[model samples]
Target chain A: MMVVISYDVSTETADGKKRLRKVAKACESHAQRVQNSVFEADLDYSSFMKLKGELLKIMNKDTDSMRFYYLGNHWQRKVEHFGIKKGYNPEGTIIV
Target chain B: MMVVISYDVSTETADGKKRLRKVAKACESHAQRVQNSVFEADLDYSSFMKLKGELLKIMNKDTDSMRFYYLGNHWQRKVEHFGIKKGYNPEGTIIV
Candidate 1:
């Protein structure tokens, strides 16, 4: 399955900034950054559950929010992007 | 059609901040703000095109990027949200 994870962590305090970095790092480990706070990844059922659990622990309920869009396995057809930066396929190979 | 619009505006400079506000305003006019930088809306083809064009004009190509996720009309099942804040249906009626 392919999931699109987008989050907003309140950065009003030092703790909030730390949480934001942790959350971003967690997402980056499992997916590719699609935007500043949005990521795209293709994972199995177990990996997806683990990723979700990790993120849930990092974000504050009172000041932070996250959304997961289940793009399924055919997300390429569902997304339309506009800008100079183009998105990379979640299933594609990268040399880097 | 249902569209999910998300953006990342570079806010390093005064001009970038201004552009960010403008881009956000453009999105809010047509959609419900789902997160800090994400929005969801149900719009017709012409309306979607107009909104996209307006946003494109406001965002800088070199410093900003935007994405539109076409969830068709059955977006209710495609989205999975997490956190304290709950999501409202784009098709639902709002008294305010």
Candidate 2:
């Protein structure tokens, strides 16, 4: 699976640098620097959940924000009926 | 190469219908209807070029516009130095 994650955070937190460090370190395996503060990479489903969970936990209590852009194959919009499969043909995928 | 194409035209063109028709038809083989005017598909590089060329030619003389989002593997940012190989491992790619 290949993933692309681009994120930016408000620079208002006293621990802004610390938070960013935690984020980078936590997602080290699934990401590499893209832009100065943005990172991108690939990971499986379990890694995805773990990364997201870690991000949520690592953020400053209530003063920080984040956004993720999952790019490449193996990426899909979450759906209740059809979650995810190990692999699927990616011809003509309509993404919302 | 998987492609995700979402296009919205400027509504003021009188030939909007014709232009859209051309675009839809040009990309018909590489795409399938996703939203009312949006489409998604997979196509090799040669096919993608043909579709783009057709769209450019069929568009109103000076009344419309278009954009393309090439998605998934085989889809890549144009780079002069690293050109493109038929296939490449897509993990940890640092796309610009």
Candidate 3:
């Protein structure tokens, strides 16, 4: 499955700032950062659950916001992108 | 259908900034701003196509990027939200 995860963490205080970094780091470990607070991850059910758990632990329930869009296997057809930001195939090769 | 629209419009130039505002305004007419550049919209197929057309007109093909996630009618079950941001029922009432 390809999961699209987007988050908004409050950065009004030092604690919030730390949490923001933690959330970003957790997502970075499992996905590609398409935007500053948005990530795209291709994972199996179990891996997705584990990633979600890690994020839940780091996010502030009262101030931060996180959303997960389960794009499933047919995400390629469901997502439409336009303009300059290059789109990547979740199942394609990366030469990095 | 409920669509999740997100965009990254370059603000490195005056024209880019103008386009940003235009894009935001167009989205604001049809959806709710969930973040700086993210919006959630509830629309039928025709409305979605119309909005997409208007947005394409305002967006820059070379430096701006727009993505649309078609969540279909069962979006509520597919979307999961956590933390402070309140989720709105697309089919619910708005008392104003």
**Individual DockQ of the candidates?**
0.64, 0.03, 0.63
Off by over 4 Å in 2: A1-96, B11-13, B74-96
Interface RMSD score of each model: 1.4, 17.9, 1.7
Better of 2 and 3 by lDDT: 3
TM-scores, all candidates, are 0.82, 0.37, 0.76
RMSD of each: 5.9, 17.2, 6.1
lDDT of the structure predicted as candidate 2: 0.48
lDDT of 1 by residue, B44-73 (tens): 999989988998898887767788888787
| TM-score pick, better of 1 and 3 | 1
CAPRI class of candidate 1: medium
Docking class of 2: incorrect
Model 3's CAPRI class is medium
TM-score of predicted chain A against the true chain A, for each candidate: 0.80, 0.61, 0.76
Report model 1's TM-score to 2 decimal places: 0.82
Candidate 1 chain A: 10-residue stretch with minimal lDDT: A87-96
Interface RMSD of 2: 17.9
Candidate number 1, chain A TM-score: 0.80
User: What is the C-alpha lDDT profile of model 1 across A1-96, one tens digit per residue?
Assistant: 888888876565888778767776776668887776778778998998998999899988776788888877777898987775644333321222
Comparing 2 with 3 on DockQ, the higher-scoring candidate is 3
Fnat of all models, as shown: 0.75, 0.00, 0.83
Superposed by TM-score, candidate 2 places the C-alpha of residue A20 at a distance from the truth, in angstroms, of: 35
User: Which prediction has the highest TM-score against the true structure?
Assistant: 1
